[model samples]
Each structure stands twice: as structure tokens, then as C-alpha cells.
Target: MNSPIIQLEHINKQFKNKLAVSNLSLEIQPGSIVAILGPNGAGKTTTMKMLLGMSKPTSGKISVLGQSPNHQQVRQQIGVMLQDVSVIDGLTVREVIRMVHSYYRNPLPIDEIELLTGLSEIDLKRRAEKLSGGQKRSLNFALAMAGNPKLLFLDEPTVGMDSETRIHFWKQVRQLTQTGKTVLFTTHYLQEADEAADRIILFSEGRIIADGTPESLKSGLTKRILSFSAQHGMIPGESASPSDTQPDHNNANSPHIHIKAQIAMLPNVDQVEYRNGRWSLYTTDTDTLIRDVIQRQLPVRDIRIETGQLDDAYAELLATMKEEQ
Candidate 1:
């Protein structure tokens, strides 16, 4: 693989007594779309600001495009769409685009920018102050792309967009990567990361807890749910009785509870709950449970297995980190 477009080494940022970023290091490959994820106070914004030269790290090395992040020449090759940027009120959309375009010696054409960002004829004529929230975000994205940047930084770029607009915006992002542009973005929307990012880096308490392709991250969180409706009388625990189940209840003579106890003892099974004649088994290995059920002939119906999703993995990882701390 080629050298990374961006690299950070042991980056740290401190404010007063608080440490915002803690020994963080990361690399962004060329033409990759990387999504940075974390809860509040996870040093996400601080990390991005350090890379954009908007903030200085208290300690450690930072490089963008093989140069120091604050290097003058680096400015021409990068674009940023910040969540808190306020547009200048007096200019029309077209005028604002033209003004930013002038800063780059060889920027994209005004017409191409308009098309790529979904700026319409009416939008072009409207003053910056008059555009709706979604329109303003679109304008922000348009301004970022005005430089034909080699690397783009988007901080919640779809914050105000409706579902349809957000979908369209993701398409434009893919187009940029197709042309060999690198993108690093921070978003509260985990689904967006799952759908758009080539790789995801999850941060917690100012540290990276997970880093990989979305599939890889989720696959590591291997929990799956198996639900099946029992046809015979309910198992001992499946009934609403408080009485402890007799040992005989799960013996070979009693098939329902026997199968239930057998399943609960499986190597990968986590827990088993029964309600309304339906048994819900939580396990890390769904195939083993399925095969056992078939082998035991437990008279089950409407069996369903649900694989772990990215959101589930993200939550589980964060919760685990909190507990560990």
C-alpha cells in the first residue's frame, strides 16, 4: 500500500487540567472515505481541528499530505465543512461560490460546482441569509468543494439535510473518492458511517476502541439472537410460576425443559428467556443452536435468527469501555 495521505503520531491535546486527546495515532490512506465516530468529549473535534491547523496539539506530531498540517502549501489542497461555520450574510449563493473559487489557482468550474452540490438556479440567486437550513448546508458543502480539494473534512455535513438530500449528498461523496480524493468526516449518525465509510474508527474516552472496515468491526461483536415458538407445552421457566424447577423437569423424561436446559448449556449461549410460549435465546453462535434444535427434534416453529448490526456493536463497545473504566 502507498503511504498514507494523513498521519498522526502520539497526538495529545490538553486544556487546563483536562486531557482532551490521549496518545492518539491514526492514518488515512489516499482515496479512502474514513468516518470518525465517538460520543461527546471523545476528542473527535479536537483531533480534526489539529489536522486542519485550526488548533494546536499540546504534544505530538501531525502531518497532512506529507507536510506539516499548518504548512502554507497544504491549504490549497484541503477543504473543510465545519458544523458551526456561519455564512456571511450579504452575498448571493453564486457570489459566495465565486469568491471562494478565486482563492484556488485552479478550482473547479462554477457550473460544475453548482451541479455537483445540487445548487439550483433559484438557489444561486438567493442571498446567503435567505436560504433554509438544508440549503445553507448544501451551500457549505459547495464552498468546501470549490477548491477541488485533494482531501475533504466534513463535520456533520448532512446535519440539516432531509433524508432525500442526505442520500444525494452521499452519492457526491462517492464521486469524489472515485476521482482519488480522500475524505474524513465526523457524524452522529452511525447509519451514515455504516453505509458510506470504507473504514470506521470508533473513539471512546479519547482513545480508539475499534478500527476496521464496518463488517470487520461488527463481525467481532458476534452476538446473535435466536427466536423460536415452541409447539408443545411450555418449558418449566417458560411458565409464569415462581417455584424452582425440579431436577426432573429438565431430565430426559421431559423433552421441553430438557431441550431448554441443553440449549442453555451450549458453549456460545449467553442467556435464555421464555415468554408467551416463545423462547428467545441469545448466543454468539447461532449455527450451533440451530443444528442442536434440529438434532434434538424439539418441535419448534417459525424459527428466526438475527445477526448483530453495526449499531449494536457500537453501543456494546462503548458500554463495555465505560464499565471497564
Candidate 2:
């Protein structure tokens, strides 16, 4: 395997009396997309700044491309699109691109940068400072690519983009990875990371809390809910319905009084609840439970599935952290 393109050892950062990042350490494998996620003031921004050579770590070693992050050669091989996109005083977008191109020995072509960033001819002619937020971000994106860097660092890249543009941006990033470019981005959009990154690193309180693929972090920490409206049905190798279940005194006339218990007996079902004429079954093994539901030929309709999302996992992790503290 190729050695990591970036590495950090016992890294920490402090501001005045506040400890921004605490004992953070991780490595980014070459050609992989990684997302750094956390709430505000979680040290995510600070860490990225250090990696970009804009800030010095209070203590510890950081290496990018086998050399110090601040090394001139290493700086030339990386591109950055910061959260606050900057514009040159009076340069047009096209001129801004050209100026950055002059700094790199081998730069990406202007037309290709335009194609990758959705910059129009009119946009290229406009003064950089006069562009809208999204437009400025696109210009920033184009400038970052001008150097044709092997590694990219983007913070809140899609903040001001419309849905179509946001979608396009991620698609472009994915394609860039196919050519062996590595990307590291930080975003509050958990779903974006869930959909885009090959791996995810979660940070909180300036410390590493979790690091794994989206699937690995989600499994065993969250649940999936399967729901459908079902008529009384039979379970193979078991009675069609429990005959001995005592009728509840208050709900003796209600059909749902016994239905809950009957559904609870389904394979791999952990909890069953019914509301609005639909039954929701909670289970970790939705696949097994779904198969059982189908094979039994139960009279069911309006089948719906709700898998635990990254948002759910993030919340669960945060709550756990609070309880531990």
C-alpha cells in the first residue's frame, strides 16, 4: 500500500487558555476522500489550518507528502478552498485564475478549471469581488485547481451553492479521486460525508472520538425501522396468533390490543409499536426481519423502511459523550 499522504503525531493546539485540539493523531491514505466532522469549536477548523501550514501546532509533528506541512515544495503540491473564499483586489475571475497558474510549474488549463467549477464566460469576465457568495466559491474552487495539486483541502465547500451546484460539486470531487487525487473536507452536512467520503473521522472537544467508514460507525450504534399495515397473519411453525393472550380490560374491543404482541414474535424483531394504522418494527437485522415478513406471505401493504441515518449516529455519539462527562 502507498504510504499515507498526511500524518499527525500527538498533535495539540491551544488558544490563550483554551485547549483547541487535544492529542489528535491520524493519517490520511493516499488517493482517499476523508471527512472531518464535529460541532463548532470542536478543533476541526484549527486542525485544518495547521495542516494548511497557516498555524503552528503547540506541540507534535505533522507531515504532508513526507515533509513538514510548511515546506515550500509540500505547499506547492496541495490546494485549499477555505471557508471564507478570498478575491484579489480588482482582478477578474479569469485573471485570478491566470495569476495562480503562474505560481505552479504545471497548472491545470483555464478551460478545464472552468468546466470543473461551473464558471461561465461571463463569470470569468466579472470582477472577483463583485461575484455573489456562490459565485465567489466557484471562483475559489477554480483557483484551487489551477495548481493541479495532488491533495485538496476544502472547508464548507458547498455552503452557498444551490442544490444543483452542490450536487455537481460533489460529483466533480468524486471524479477527481479516480485520477488518484486525495481530498480532505470538513462540513456540517453529515449526509454529504455519508454519501461522499470513503472514510470518516469524527472529532469532539479537540480529541479523536471515532474513525471508520460510514457503515462501520453506523452499525451496532443505531437501528432500522420497518413499518407496514398488516392484517392478522400466521407465523410458520407457530400458532397463527397467540390464543392465550389475556385481553386487556380497557381495550377488549380494540383490534390492536393483541396485534402488538403477535407482531413482536416476528423473527429478529426487537420492539414493535403501532400507530396511525401502521406497525413499526425496530430491528438491527432489517434484512432478516424483512425476509421473514415476506416469506410468511402476511397480508401487508404500504411497506416502508427507515434506516438509521448518520444524523442519528452523530446524535447518539454526542449524547453518550455528555453522559460520560
Candidate 3:
């Protein structure tokens, strides 16, 4: 296997009394697309800054392209599309692309960059400052490609893009990896990471909280949901006996206490809820739950099953981690 394209070892970054990133370590191979995920103030942007050599870590080490990220050669091989982009004055879109091209030894052709960015000929003729927000984002994407960098760092790269443009952007990003390039992107849109990344690294409280493929991370949660509806006053408790009924003095509008009392006995059930006259069962093993319900001959109707999504797992993991803290 080839060497890791990026590596961070026991990295820590502090700002005054606040710790931004703490004891973080991970590696990414070439040709991989990685998603760095975290809630606000979770140190994701800080880590990106360190990796880009825009800031120094308080301690530990970092490597990009098998050399210190601060090295000029490494910088030349890196492409950055930061959240805040600056538009050069007095430059038309074409002129801007050409100017960025001049900064690189051998850049991707302007035509290829235009195709990759969905830039039309008319857009190429417009002045940079006059472009709309989405247009500017596309230009930023174009600039990132201009150098033909081995590594691309994109921060919220699709924020302003329309759905069609957003889809096209990711399609182009995938094509970039086919050429052995690496991509590291951070986004508020978890679905993008779920659909695009080879791996996800989650951060919280200045540390790495979770790291794995999207499927693996989701598997960590009890992900299958079995739900069914029942008519009012019709109840199907997984293992409820008449004696199991109890009073819900605490919640007057809560589901029937008798039904709630028997929820604990459900097979493979992690959580159970009644909302909108539907019983939603949270479980890891939907098959077992389904079988148990069938054998019991419950009066439930409109049965449905749903697999857990990345956002579900993300929420669960962060809640769990917060509890541990």
C-alpha cells in the first residue's frame, strides 16, 4: 500500500485559556476522500488550519505529502478553498483563473477548470466581484483546481450552490480522486459526507470522538426502527400482561401507562415511543422484533422498517460522548 497522504500525531492547539484541538491523531491515504465532522466550536476548523500550515499546533506533529506541512513544496501541492474567499479587484473571471494558473508550475487548463466548475462562457467574461454568491463559490472551486494540487482542502464548498450545481460539484470531486488526488472537506451537510466520503472523523470538545467509514459509524448505533400504527384504545404490548399496567401520574397526555409498562419486555428493543398514534420501536435487530410481534399476534397495522442514517448515528454518538464527559 502507498504511504498515508496526511498524518497528525498527538496534535494539540490552544488559544489562550481555551483548547481547540487536543491529542488528535489520524492518517489518510492518497486517493481517499475524508470528512472532518463536528458541531460548532469542536476544533474542526482549527485542525484544518494547522494542516494547511496557516497556523501552528501548540504541540505534536503533522505531515502532509510525507513532509512537514509548512514546507514550500508541500504547500505547492495543496489546494485550499476556505470558507471566506477573497475576490481579486479589476479581474474578470477569466483573468482571475489565468492569474491563479500562473502561480502553479503546470496547472489544469482553463477549459478543464471551467468544465469541472460548471463555469459558462458568459460567467468567464463577468468580473469576479459582480458574481452572485453561488457563482463566487464556483469560482473558488475553480481556483482550487487551478493548481492541479495533489491534496484539496474544501471548507463548506457547496454552501451556496443550488441542488443541481451541488450535485455536479461532488461529481467532479469524485472524478478528481480517480486521478489519485486526495480530498478533505468539512460541511454542515452530513448527507454530503455520507454520500461522498471514504471515511469520517468526528470531533468534540477538542478531541477525536469517532473515526470510521460511514456504514461502520452508523452500525455503532442501534439503527433499525420498527414502527406501526394502532387504532385508539387498541394496544399491542410486546409482552404486557394485564397486571403489568400502571398509572402515568407524571404525564397526563402520555401514551397509555399499560402499554408503556410492557415496552421494557420487547425483544431487542433499545427504545420505544408513541407519537402521532404510532408506536415507533428502536432496535438493533428489526428481524427479531418483527418475528416476536408476529408470533404474539399484535393488532398493530401499517408496519414499517427504517435503517438508521448517518445523522442518526452522529446525534447518538455526540450525546453518548457528552454523557461520558
Candidate 4:
């Protein structure tokens, strides 16, 4: 693997009354897209600013492209899009792109920027102040690309983008990663990170609480939801009781209630909700549940098993962290 493009070791940042970041250490690999995720006041922005050299750490060392983050040589190789937009007002989009491009020895062509960023011809001519929120975000992304830097930092880069535009932006980002550019982005959109990032680092209360691929994180905190609709005579309070006059399947409390009870007893089964002839089972051991269902001859149809999602994992992860604190 290539050497890490950015590294922070035992970094700490303190304000007058609070510690914004605490002993944080991370290494970002080249050509990889890493998403920094956390709830509000989780030190996410502080960590990004420290890595970009916009804010100095109270202690410890930091490096970008194998040099001090603030080093002029390293600065030239990095592009940054901050959460707070700072482009001069009244400047045409093309002019702003050109101005930032001039600072770099090798910059992407203006036309290429427009194409890659999904900026229309009219957008290029419009003044920065006149652009809508989403348009301004697109321009911000275009400016970041102008430097043709090896590494890029985007904090909430898709803040105001519509769904279609956000999807386009991810496609462009993937193209950049293909050409060996490293990107470190922070987003409140968990699904965006889940979809776009190769790795996710979750921060909580000024520290990294979790780090892994989205699938792995989801597996850790979430369970598959197995659902099926069936008409079994299972009532809430009683076990299956088949009457002599009624068939077992027709006994309102017999088959369905029995199956529900059996499933609830299975190891690793979290919860079960049954209503209106529909059953929703939450479990980590889905295979066992399936096997038991088959072996027990539970009457079920329209079976649907949904894999765990990153959103559920994120919520559970934070909830667990809060408990630990």
C-alpha cells in the first residue's frame, strides 16, 4: 500500500473552557475516500480543521503528504472546501475558478471543471453571490478541483445539493479516486457516507468511537429484519390452542402464536412484532430463525429479509457510546 497521505498522532485541541479534540490519531491512505462522521459537537470539524492546518493542535504532531500539515509544499498539494463558503461576492464562477487555478502549478482546465462539477454554461457566467445554495456548493466543489491537488478535504460538501446533484457529485468523486486522489470528507448524511466512502470513522465526544467499512459497522450494531405475512390463529396472550371443531391452522391462537413464541426463544433473536397477520422479527441469527421456521412448519408467505442499514448502525453505535459515557 502507498504511504498514508495524511497522519495525525496524539493530536489535541483545547479552547478556553473546552477540549475540542482529544488525543485523536488517524492515518488516511492515498486514493481512498474516508468519511468522518459524528453527531453535533463530536469534534468532527475540529479534527478536519487540524488536519487542514487551519487550526493548530495544542499538542502532538501532524503530517500531510509526509510533511508538516502547514508546510508550504504540502499546502500546495492539498485542496480544501470548508463548511463555511468564503468566495468573494460579485465574481463570476469562471473568474473565481480561474483565480484559484492560477495559484497551482498544474490546474484542471476551466471546461473540465465545469463538466466534472455539473455546472451549466449559465452557471459559469453567473456571479457567485447570485447562485442558489446548491449552485454555490457546486461552485465550491469546482474550486476545490481547480488546484488538481493530490488530496482534498470537503466538509459537508453536499449540504445544499439536491438528490440528483448529490448523486452526480459522488460519481465525479469516484472518478477522481480512480486517478489516485485521496479525499477526506465529513457529512451529516449518513447514507451518503455509507454509499460513497470506502471507510468510515465515527467520532463521539472528541474521540473516535468506531472505525470500519459501512458493512462491518452495521453488522456490529444492527440486526437483519425478517418479515413475513401469514394468517395463523395467534392471539397476543395465549399459546396455540387448537379446538376439536377448528383446524390447527384456523385456531386464532394456535400456529401463529406458537411460532412467535418459538422464534422469541431462539438465541440472538432481539424482538418480534406481530400484527394484522404480519410478523416482523429482529434477529442477529437470521439463519437459525429461517431453519427453525422451516423445521417447525410455520405458515408464512411473502417472506422478506432486509439487511441491516448504516443508519440503524449509526444510531445504535451512538446510543451505545452514550451508555458507556
Candidate 5:
């Protein structure tokens, strides 16, 4: 395995009375894309800033490309697209790319940068201020890649991009990784991480909640939801029906039954609605729950079982973390 291209050892950062990032340690390998995912104020931006040397760590150490982040040589091998736009508005698209290229020793060819970024459609002569949000984002990407840096940091790179442009941007990112450049980025969009990252680090409350390949993180959350519909009416909860309300027609009436069972203790199962002649249940252990439901609940009319989706796992993980905190 290759040595880590970036390393953060027990990194901590504080502001006044608040600890933005707390004892966060992470590693990024060469040619890999690692995405940091979190909600607002989770310290993702602060972590990235620390790695870039824009903000100093209150404690701990950070190294990028085997050297301290503050090292001039290490700085040359990195490119950044901050959440706050940093381009000069007066420069044209081509001019901005050229200016960034001028700062690097062996930048990518100007025509290649234009082609790779799909900037051919934009008027290269048009000033950055005149471009649409998506256009500007594409230009930002071009500038970041212009230097051909070995490591790149993109903070919320697709914030205002349209679906088509975002798709194109991801394609370009994949191509970059193929060329041996490492990418470390932070995104609020979990789907973006799912699509682009080879590995995902989930951050919550100034800590790493989870870290693994997208599939591994998903598989680690292996949960199944079992659902079914029944002809007979079923009570939603575990509580028994009131004895006083028992009607003589209870034995004869065939009302729809709905039961919601949560398997593996996942907190996704709300009250199951079984009106209109249908029954449904939600659970994390599909096969086991299905078996249990079949044996215990009995007489299910139709059954369906499926693994928990990425969104479901993510929600459950965060909810569990929040509850613990």
C-alpha cells in the first residue's frame, strides 16, 4: 500500500470558547478520493481549513504530501476550491485559468484545461462575474485542476450547480483520480459522496462517526425492512385493544391489518398504517423479521423484504450518534 498523502494526527481547533474540531485524526492515500460528510457546524469546513494551513490547529499536527501543510513545496502540490468563492471577478475565464497556471511549475496545457472542464461552451473572454453560477463552478474546477496538483481540496464544490453540470463535474473528478491525483473534499450532499468518494468519513459533533468505503459503511449498517399486507385488521402497536370496545362483529369482520416491526433496534419504524385493506411493516432484519412475523403475527397476505438503503443507514447512524451524545 502507498503511504498516506495527507495525515492529521489528533488535530484540534478552537475559536474563543468553542472547539470547532476536536481530536480529529484522518488519512488520505495517494490517488484516492475521500469525502468528509456532515451537517452545518459539524467542523468539516474547519478541518479542511486546518489541512490547508488557512487556519492553525490549536493542538496536534497535520501533514500534506509527506510535509507540513505550511511548507512551501507542499503548498505547491495542492489546489483548493473553497466554499467561499476565491476567484477575482474581473478576470475572464481564460485569464483566470492562465493566471493559476502561471503560478505552477508545470501546469496542464491551456487547451487541455479548457477541454477537460467543458469550458468550450462558455465564452472564454467573458468575465468571471458575468458567468452563471454553474458556469463559474466549472471555471473554478478548471482553475483548481490547471496546476495539475498531486492533491486537491474541494469544499462543497457543487453547491449551486445544476444536475447536468454536477454530473459532468463528477465525471471530470473521476478522470482526475485516474491520473493519480488525490482528492479530499467536504460535501453536505451525501449522494455526492456516495457517487464520487472511494471512501467516506462521516463527521458529527467534532468527531469521526464513521469511516469506510461507501459499500463497507453501507454494508456495516446491514439492516432489512420487512413489510406485508394482510386481509384481517391488525392493531398497529403492541398494546392490546380495549376490552370494553370489543364488538360482536370482531370475529366476522375482515378489516385490513397493519403492523410495523423494527428489527435490529433501528429507529426507522414509525406506526404502520393499515387502513384501506392493506398491511405494512418496517424492520431492519428482513429475513428474521419476516420469519418472526410469519410465525408470530401469522396469516400475512403479501410480504416484501429489502435491505436498508444508504439514506436509511445514514439517518440511523446520525440519530444513534446524536442520542448517545
Candidate 6:
């Protein structure tokens, strides 16, 4: 394995009265895209600022490209596209890119940068203030890439971009990684991370909640939901009594019996509904539930089980985490 391009060791950052980032540690390898995912005020932006040496860490150490973040040489090798980047309104797109390129020793060709960023239609003579939000975002990316830095920090790089432009931007990002450039970005869009990043690090309450490849994170949280529609309206209880025939009776009427057993004894159970038919019940072991229902001669329809998608896994993981908290 290659050495990590960025390493954070027991990093902690605190404001006057609150700890924005706890003792967080992370390692980002070269030539790969790593996405940092978190909700608002989760210390994601603070961590990024510390990594860029824009804010001093309250404690711990950080290294970028095997050098301290404060080192000028290391800073020169890193490109930053902050969420709140402001450009000189009077400068044109081409002028801004050229100005940024002048700071680096060997910047990429201007024509190549323009093509890679899909800024060809952006008038080179048009002032930065005249561009739309998406165009401005693309210009920011173009300026960030002008330095030809080994590592790039993009904070919500595709914010305000149209769907087509966002797709185009990811393609450009992939091209950068192909040439051994490392990308570390923060995005709220899980789908964007799924499509763009090779690895994902999820943060919550100033802590690293999860870290792995997108597929691995998804598969680890994969659940099987057995769902079907019922032909008749029958309350789904967890357990049922062998002799209990009152379908309208609330499960609270018999608190001693297991609700799961009640569900097993129901006849013609097409699906499990709870709370007066408000919510549906999904289980991993549908075979047992189905077999039990079949043995009881229940008329079930459209019973099937399959792997849940990424969105389902993501919601389940977050909900589980919230419950634990």
C-alpha cells in the first residue's frame, strides 16, 4: 500500500465554549478520492480548514504530503476550493485561472484546463460577476486545478450546479485521479459520494462514525425487507393465539401472548401491517414467516424478498446510530 498523502493524528479543535472537532484521526491515500460526509455543524468544515492550515488545531498533529500543513512547500502542492471562495468581480474567467496558474511552477495548459472544466462556453472576456452560480462554481474548480496540485480540497464543489454539470464535474475529477492526484472533498449528497468517491468517511457529532468504500459501507448495512400487499384489511400483530379469531381486537387486549406468534397464525396474510394499517413490517427471515403463514393455509400474495438498495441501508444505518446515541 502507498503512504497516505494526508494524515490526522488525534486532532482536536475547540471553540470558546464547544469542541467543534473531537479527537479525530484519518489517513487519506494518494491517487484516490475520499469523501467526508456529515450533517451541518458536524465539524466537517472546521476539519477541512485545519487541514489547510487556515485554522490552528487546539491539539494534535496534521501532516499533508509528509510535511506540516504550515510548510510553504506543502501548501504550494495543495489546491483548495473552499465553499465561500470569492473572486475579484472585475476579473474574467480566463484572467482568474491565469493568475492562479502563475503561482505554481508547472501548471497545466490553459486550453486543457478550460476543456476539462467545461468552461469553453464561458466567455474568456466576461467578468466573474456576470457568471451564474453553476458557472462560478466551474470557474472555481478551474482555478483550483490551475496549480496542478498533487492534492485538492473541494468543499461542496458541485453546489448549485445543474445535474448535467455535476456529472461533467465528476468526470473531470475521475480524470484527475487517473493521473495520481488525490481528492478530498465534503458533500452532503450521498449519491454524489456513491458515484465519485472510492472511499467514504461518515462523521457525526465530531466523531468518525464510519469509514470504508461506498460498496462496503452499503453492503455492511444491507438488510432484506420482505414486503407485500394484502387483499383484505387485517391488522398485523407480532404474535397471534391459536384460538383467537377476533381480528379487530387490539394486541393490548392480550399482553401476555407473543405478537410474533399472532402474526404466524393469521390466515391469508399477504403482508404485515401495523398500527391500524399505517406501517408495514419487513423482516430478514421471510421464509420462516411465509412458511408459518402457509402452514396455517393463509392466502398470501406477492411475497418476495430481495437485497435492499443503498438508500435503504443508509437510512437504516443512520437510524440505528441515532438510536444508539
Q: Candidate 5, residues 1-325: lDDT per residue as tens digits?
A: 8899999999888899999899999888899999998888989989888888888999998988888888999888888887765558788888877887888888889988887657655578788788877777778888887878999999999988899989999998998899999999999788789889999998887889889988878776655555555432344432333342222324433122122222223244443534344444554556565556555645566676545456666787998876887
The estimated TM-scores of all candidates read 0.83, 0.81, 0.84, 0.84, 0.80, 0.78
Name the candidate, 3 or 4, with the larger lDDT value.
Answer: 3
Q: What clash pairs does model 4 have? A: 233-252, 233-253, 234-252, 240-254
Compared with the true structure, what per-residue lDDT tens digits does model 6 show for residues 68-180?
88898987788888887567788887787778778888888988777765765646668887887888888889888887899999999999899999988999999899999
Candidate 1, superposed: residue stretches over 4 Å from native:
227-281, 295-306
Compared with the true structure, model 1 gives a TM-score of: 0.83
Q: Kindly list the per-residue Cα lDDT of model 2 for residues 1-325, writing each as its tens digit.
A: 8989999999989899999999888999988999999999989999999998999999999999999888999888999999987799798887888788889888898688778668778878988898888888877887888889999999989899888888888898999899999999999999999999989988899997889999888874757889987544333333335443433437654345546655666887878766665888888787888888778666678888876678778887888899999
What C-alpha lDDT values do all the predictions have?
0.85, 0.84, 0.85, 0.83, 0.76, 0.77
Clashes of 3: 0
So what's the TM-score on candidate 4? Answer: 0.84
> How does residue 11 of candidate 4 score in lDDT?
89
lDDT of 4 by residue, 1-325 (tens): 6888989999888999898889999888999999999889999999888888888999989989999888998888888888886667888888888787788888898788777657788878888788878878888888888878899999999998899999988999999999999999999999999999999999988999889998888878557888887544443444443342223456555565466666666666787877555678888777888887777666677888877678888888778877887
Looking at model 1, report the run of 10 residues with the lowest lDDT sum: 239-248
Tens-digit per-residue lDDT, 166-251, candidate 1:
99999999989999999999999999999999999998877899999998998787688888876444444443333333323534
Q: Which candidate, 2 or 5, has the higher lDDT?
A: 2
What is the lDDT for 39 in model 1?
86
Model 3, residue 73: C-alpha shift (Å): 0.7
